[model samples]
Target: MDLRFDHLIHAVSDPERARHAFADRFGWHTVAGGEHPGFATYNALAYFGLPYIEWVGVRKPEVAAERPFGRDVLRVLRAGEGPMQFAVRTNDIVGMADRWSRAGLVHEGPIEASRVRPDGVTLRWRMLFPAQEPGKLLLPFVIEWPAPDEVRLADLRQSGLSPDPAAAPRLRAVHAVVGDLARLRRSMDAYFPGVLEPCESSEQGRGVRWTCGEVTVFVWEPAEGALRRVLDTVGERPFLAEFERTAGVRTRTAADAARRLEAAGAPVHGLWVVTSE
Candidate 1:
């Protein structure tokens, strides 16, 4: 039941504008995504590898108001376009659900869902949403695709959807600015058991870093600083997505990072964060 960071969901007012924004911001190849059959939402996508960016917008307000996930998207968009959610890829979703039950964590389905691709092909999968807990950052939903993870990666390459890992700046981490970083770290241990590790305090603030093979999730709570202001403003949410820079990327101050994060609200393309390391 090993899980890896899968993709970031960015909520937007318009999916097409988001696609163009990603193209302009990172020079990433974007696709014109299609509608989800039941959710009343549509998407625009940009793939760096397995962990891609999904820009989702409400297509039918009445229908969207009926679905919980759709309502979540609408709530995020009301605050303006920004990173909305994250999900992990898993192979054994049933086992994961059992584990969650044993751990005393509440969860909703291994629900079956599908989106009809613009090319008229249907892509199906199952998702399990872990309820968000107090004092913890938002819990990432778990996704189990129809094929094995490697098979999906290969298919993405063959379909010309994902760029080669070495050539593209694949998503490296999702950084959350939240209150009580220590409590969030403890909560993650309950959900993920021992994968999260200690991270040093720096321009990124102080928190724990969780790695699930390919991508990392960082939770930070700074003392009266830019990151703290973010928590005060947005409450607990993922504020920045780090991507591997091809060259000349160095760390910046929290103020600079916060400024870049503000820039992310427009058009909903993820903000670029890279470390010299």
Candidate 2:
């Protein structure tokens, strides 16, 4: 199964607030995404071409806990906002389930789902969630869109859901904060298989890395500084993302939040544009 970085899901109490935070403070473009028809969530989208951010929010607290995705997000929102989960895309989601079975990983889905866009056009996809094991953190879910890559890219551009490819800065890597580095690597290795390696993130702490084309994922042990706070707050999650420095984005410009995260650790002002300061 060929897996690549897809959208990152940043769970929030309010989709609107998360959208404004990213656009007004972080200098990113976000658009309204429609609700999941049967799920207790809605979202706003920040499209960095194909690799995007989905700001998902709960619609009905009473119903949210009924689904696996909702239950996980609600579990983290109790600790306040953070990067709750991320996903990888593949052309074959069922094949992915087969891969997981062979690797001895438990999972759920390849279940069909769909949501209508704000423009009234309905979109559909399938998802496979790797069941988080006892005493271990969750891994990225696998998603498969019905359309081919080129066709989807064209649709995003023409429909204005995503900017032209070059108009957006590249997504460099995702910074994941985990409690046990060794355990997380074990899961990531089973999921990605034979691609994990060690990496040193100045802001996030020393951890392992695995790359899928242009996007890389770094799993870090929260340093004793500000990063430690993130661990205490959100438990194990991908707390931040780094992007290629673009016009509105800076290169470790010493912004207040950046300063604190810097003390915690990252590479060359690692978070670059992710902080609100």
Candidate 3:
């Protein structure tokens, strides 16, 4: 029952521009990830260790309308740019789904899907989406990659799809601002078990932090002021802000990252912050 953060999906209207921005700011270059057949969507991937960042966009709206998640991606793009959803990786997706279902969680599919890499290697996996509501973005969908870890990494590397471990920013934490912490915790407990630890937020509201792999997931209750405004704008989602450890100690703190990104003309919407720790 090993569950860990897999990747974060950043829905963008223009993949090339977004890719360039990320590369320019964080030295994280993205590679082609091939289109989703029958979904009218395509993606570029910036690999970072085991977890990665997926820059996804709708290629054809008319075709995308046929698929549920595809349509959701289109809608998110319509609003603005930034993280749309996050996923968790599991060794046993079927068993995990069964456990979640038994615990009274509404979800759809341990559905199988595959994508062909630019180098002609096909990658396949099964995914389970917990909860059908669009607002439930904070609830991570489960994914199980069928290929062996070595084979998958090798294939991706051969296709030049892997990130530069030395240059890429290491994800340290993921802050998820939710309207109801208790409700979200109840659902998360079934999948992550004892990972969640209670804590008090700076805003004086209840918060729980879960360590998933090298990344931490923070779920905080709704608060007043700036954070509350952000939650209202983004709705209940898994991503509020991401804290990353830079490749070098010279460039530490969110201000440093923000200054560089701003100089590069990249949008700084509080999505990622650089930390010394």
The C-alpha stretches of model 3 lying farther than 4 A from their native spots are: 190-193, 240-270, 273-277
Tens digits of per-residue lDDT for model 2, 83-136:
767788899888878878887887888878788888888999999987786533
Per-residue C-alpha lDDT of model 3 across residues 46-66, encoded as one tens digit per residue: 776777878888989998987
Determine which window of 10 residues in candidate 3 has minimal summed lDDT: 248-257
Clashes of 1: 0
| Model 3 steric clash pairs | none
Q: Which ten residues in a row are the worst by lDDT in model 1?
A: 247-256
By summed lDDT, the worst window of 10 consecutive residues in model 2 runs over 247-256
- Predicted structure with the largest TM-score when compared to the true one: 1
Write model 1 residue lDDT over 1-277, tens digit each, in one string: 4888888888888999978877876678788888886778999888877888888999998889888578788777777677777888888998989998998988888888898776776899999888777333277888989988788889888887887667678677677777676776666777778877666556546676667667777666766666777677666778787666453322234444555555455323434444322
User: Between which residue pairs do clashes occur in model 2?
Assistant: 202-265, 202-266, 203-265, 203-266, 204-265
Higher-lDDT candidate of 2 and 3: 2
Q: Which stretches of candidate 1 lie over 4 Å from their true place?
A: 134-137, 164-166, 202-204, 245-277
